[model samples]
Target: MTNKPAQATLLPDNIAALTAYSSAKSEKISGNTWLNANESPYTKEACIEIRALNRYPDPQPQVVIDAYSTYASVDSDQVIMTRGADEGIELLVRTYCEPAKDRISLFLPTYGMYKVTADTHNVQINSLSQDLLLNGEVKDIINAVSGSKLVFICNPNNPTGAVTSVEKIAELTKSLANKAIVVVDEAYIEFSESYSCALLIKDFDNLVVLRTLSKAFALAGLRTGFMLGAKNTLAPVRKVIAPYPVSTVVAQIAANALCSDAITQMRRQVVILNKAKATLIDWLEQSPAVSKILSGEGNFVTLQLKDKALLTLATNTGLIMRPFKLYNQDNWLRISIGNEQELKSVKDWLNAISAQV
Candidate 1:
């Protein structure tokens, strides 16, 4: 019997180099004031009264599917519920792109999951060159379509908050027919003025829209999201998904939240956050510490701060916000639109810190 040297060769080269998603919370930093993750500050009371804990959950829960379908104004066949929108990204890559053969394209400075998911599957990732604020141009996406099997577009894009018009998204899909599947992630659509591209599922087969209860619905803790596309288009994705992707309790709670009264409450909360978003933008615009602010339609605002020390000061004073070194923007900070009390605390801290400096 002989023991061989243990080297990194045991793991695939790509897997060895992967840096998984990490957030402040993941780092065990629990702050009294949290404005990261773009989550709704309001917490929904769960209605988890499932009697069958011993039984497996449904692969596709009709109650949740129907509820989300009605909310998105689409048919149940077009909806495929997953653990979260993150899972949908993985499912798409697994279903469509062949490992080490097919490739996917994602715009820079957008959501990180699309690249992460594609990388996990050993699929090649093509970076489509486009400006963070002025990159919604269809021609740029169309030109990048060559040699790509999937294309991911995050609307009211995460981190930067830039949005692409529905017309442009539809046009991009039509232009790239059979070239790639254009996935429009609309997780923050509830907070945007643009209509969901789910309505265009019937018009174009290449378009897929991702929605989540984590944002405006205030159910981030529940971990529920959906992918809206033609049933035939998602059939392969459904096969790749777990047999029981959603828990019974999660389904029940999501169903309850989609009720008429709950939806009205969600809309009212969105209205409040929209106001907070505007206020935050206006305040940031006037702040001496802010060098530039890339305002978008998302619930959060991205700002390029004049001083990086402000981020450290905020964290030291029990305030937590997302800082990005992504896309070569090192001094950028992302602050989620929190409830009035939370945002007020941020405002107070900025004033105190600014006055001292």
Candidate 2:
């Protein structure tokens, strides 16, 4: 008896075509220079004192929930903690979208997780070009999202760093009332001046906001993130979440980070990153090697390069940056805002390369 082929017999077709998310650390390059991921170069001492690691942590850690709620200016009941903003994206698909039935709509050149998670659950994806979203046209967005059950908008959008104004988002959500659930991902909002749509949840019951401590709060290793919505809007997600969503150690650290002093420190760091981002943008704008620099409000900047040779030069110099081949935006690269020294080194390396040519 011949055995069936594993790919043909076991794996689902949707997953078979799926390309896994390649995180910056996935490169496995060991080096003194690290800037591929948009993580804080600074880290604080954990000083974690958890009562128990052997036993299971709280199914819903009150302190962690309370900390994030206060930080996001939402009530605890409006918050649900997940492994990271990534998991929150998954939970939204699992809880609301029916496999092979409900569809999710989002713009291109945005975060990869929104599409990846939606694809994993076998949900149909209606991808809209960024032209409409970037222009902030509500009617175009409404037309684009006509049949989608879940609409995902990444504010201070990734890769492009383009931000949709809070007022524009409010208008979109208002128009889509009862038509679809509006999810605003604010993963990079801390670096932007735009207000969070979490403030609009009260007005729009269907509005859901996703946030992560990974970026501005500098808690990437902890894998902490949040989902904010009205109680009824989040009810389904709460029902399907992991028994103990967050570890005790993580909860302790997250709570500490939420304290007033730490928050102030986080803000100060954001100011520094914004400065670095602006400097880098200014330098890139002047460089003859750059074709165009995309507008964004995140700690990173994306630029269309004249060629891939610059990427090779950066890599050869032990500098790591993200290339957008997977996003189908070839020849485009995202450079995360690192410490002052790191930014200077990268700028010097670019200048040296330009001088060689």
Most accurate candidate by TM-score: 2
* Residue-level lDDT tens digits of model 1 in 46-70: 7577689899988898988998899
Instruction: Give the root-mean-square deviation of each candidate in angstroms.
Output: 2.0, 1.7
Report how far off residue 127 is in candidate 1 (Å): 0.7
Model 1 clashing residue pairs (backbone):
none
Q: Which residue runs of candidate 1 sit more than 4 Å off their true CA positions?
A: 1-9, 132-137
lDDT of 1 at 329: 60
Best-performing candidate as measured by lDDT: 2
Per-residue CA lDDT of model 2 for 1-357, tens digit only, reads 999797678899889888888789877775567777998887888898855888998877898888888888889999998898999999999998999899999888788888889889999999887778878478978988998989999887887777878898899889998899999999998987456898898888889999999999998899989999999999988889988888888888888999999999999999988888889988988787888888678888888877777778788778888877624657888888899888887798679666754
Score residue 290 of candidate 1 by CA lDDT.
Answer: 83
Provide backbone clash counts, one per model.
Answer: 0, 1
Model 1 worst lDDT run, 10 consecutive residues:
128-137
- In model 1, what lDDT does residue 351 have? 84
